[model samples]
Target: MLKKLNYTNGLLNQMKHSIILLGATGFTGKLIAEKLDKDSVTFTICGRSLEKLQYLTEKCTHNHECLVLDVMKEEKIKSVLFQYEIVINCVGPFNLWGNFIRNFCVQHGKIYIDISGEQSFIEQSFMMDKLAKEKGATIIHSVSFESCMADIIASEMLDSALKYSDISSYYFFRNSKPSPGTKLTMQLSKHFPTFFIHNGKMENASPLAFHKYISFDFLPGFTKALFMPYPEILFFNKKYKVNHSASYLMLNHSDAMFLLASRKQPIESVDKILKKHQSRKHNLNENDIAKQEFTLVVQAIAEDGIKITKYVHGRNMYGITAFLVSYLVKQINSGLLLKKGIVTPSETGAWSGLWNVLIKEKLITHVQELQSDEK
Candidate 1:
């Protein structure tokens, strides 16, 4: 028998003005909660840890609540279903957890959103769109830092470009420092590859399934990066109908090592690698950034037979990520319906339509046009 959650219909409706935050104990999750608090929106922390959840909730500023509702249990999900209008899923690796929360929210007509950056998990999020819509629920996937900012920027750039030219190719380059929470989530996800997203429609490309080496001036002439094929690339490529596509990556030691260890291995084999290699402890710091910068470069081919390029830049990956998510939450809450399911940042044109929002929210420092004569 599954654990029965104590929060019921009365408690849910009582949450008239609150957001339901799943995985509230996470590093990034805590930060999302903080942002919500500052927004003056009500929210509840729902995780498997009652004591930890309680402890987390106790320190919050707004009218927040806590619930011991694990994603793995259905009955508990129902007990808490009627309480909130939106469910902000901050848990990862989303390959496993995405489906659980997504299903519950859609089935119960709860607006569901998640910050799952996993490509594989993102594919699964797309799969749920039809059902979610039929059930009259808004199911938004990839509402996190990685692709959200890119999505908004690209959408705006392309929208403006399309009015004047055709967008032939688009690329996003990103790097961010690790918050203690993000670092911890990465450690847990590697061993639990079930969190990986896969389907006959969307198969996991084996490790290095996608790769490319590109030169960038963000730092100097060139920096070597192992460009892994990301699932969200689908959102951009398919939407733009661009034949050429790639998402380059440069990960530090732990992230790079984890990606290397999880590639193409069976579940048990992957677990073995994690057990053998993972450290059980760490000293966490709030201010430590993992030495990163994520910049987006978009090249649009004008029907007039010219290639126009635009560049966008940002530092502070985690803060920027939260910033992006917070911005997205507001836009989404304002009766905007993204009827498209399973798209990359480029496909959803809302950002292009809402570029000022990105600037207003400070997600992108600048969007500048590069000289066409340079390259």
Candidate 2:
């Protein structure tokens, strides 16, 4: 059974003096850092490579420090992390690495953010909520494209429906061309088994844990890949007073087949295969110059038989994630988030605020109203 809703309060908004990027040299880490580091907040970029750390420093016009520490060196990293006000973990294949920081953060009362969206999100997160509260830490994970966008779009569509009447059901659409960083992260994250939160309870499952096939007439039929069950569905399910909530990916059939087939393989076999594969560097265009695309669709059904759908489509998932991360930093500055606990993007209104920014920036389109008779 899922844990009871225990949303606690009383977290002081303490902006940390320095925000440390754990996976500073990676693609998403680089982008988030580039986007958020204005001349204002101080950042300390930490990773395994001193050379790469120095190389990344060149990209920052703003003042930022660099530290050579690995997350695997949990003790050292945690020591540094607690000293900072906030830490952004760009490091992943997190399940493989293990979350020692969860305890450290909870025990120490630090503000932590990460780009982790692996199937093991809550398996690694929720277990630390009480501990975090005990220590006074606020932890937000999977704040990137995977689940954050889904939650925001889902919430908005549901909210728009409430403006008319009570909501009964909803659907979310996610179409995004992931950056090279996403691909590498996928490969790294696949090192662990998949699991999810079932009825607010943590349960073991496959990585491509659950899914369905969906086709939209606007484009060719794409396979809706089963990402780990993100909190978008669960959070909105409760928030909107709906009985059912589902979201699907907008992906090519080939990619879906590849992902599913890999999921079918045993973790041991997959790791062996990865070891046997040629040593190919992780990258999309081998450089950050390449752009990607992301599409968002949120549908809500009201008791009065009305549906309102919102769309946020744009290019550059890395850039968009960066934009949202920057916004969250601002929210942190303003003290909107609650006390120490594992949080998904949907749980907070980061995505709601994100939708506004995306729309205002023309990163997303306006709302489209559909009759209940329409699909």
Who wins the TM-score comparison? 2
Q: How far in Å is the alpha carbon of 152 misplaced in model 2?
A: 1.4
Clashing pairs in 2: 2-200, 2-201, 16-85, 137-340, 138-340, 292-316
Each prediction's whole-model lDDT (CA): 0.56, 0.59
TM-scores of the candidates are 0.74, 0.75
lDDT of 2 by residue, 1-375 (tens): 111112123211233445777887777787777777752556666777777777777767776766666677665665567667777777665665537765566677877777666655545577667777777788777677655776665655556335333222122334334555455546555555554334434345544666766544443565464544444544454355553444455567777777677776645555654564326555454233334445555555565566665555565556666677777877776767664566656665554455567778665554443445333
In TM-score terms, candidate 2 sits at 0.75
Over 4 Å off, model 1: 1-18, 159-204, 223-225, 250-279, 290-292, 299-305, 332-365, 371-375
C-alpha root-mean-square deviation, each candidate: 6.0, 8.5
| Candidate with the greatest lDDT versus the true structure | 2
For candidate 1, the TM-score is 0.74
Deviation from native of the Cα of residue 94 in model 1, angstroms: 1.1
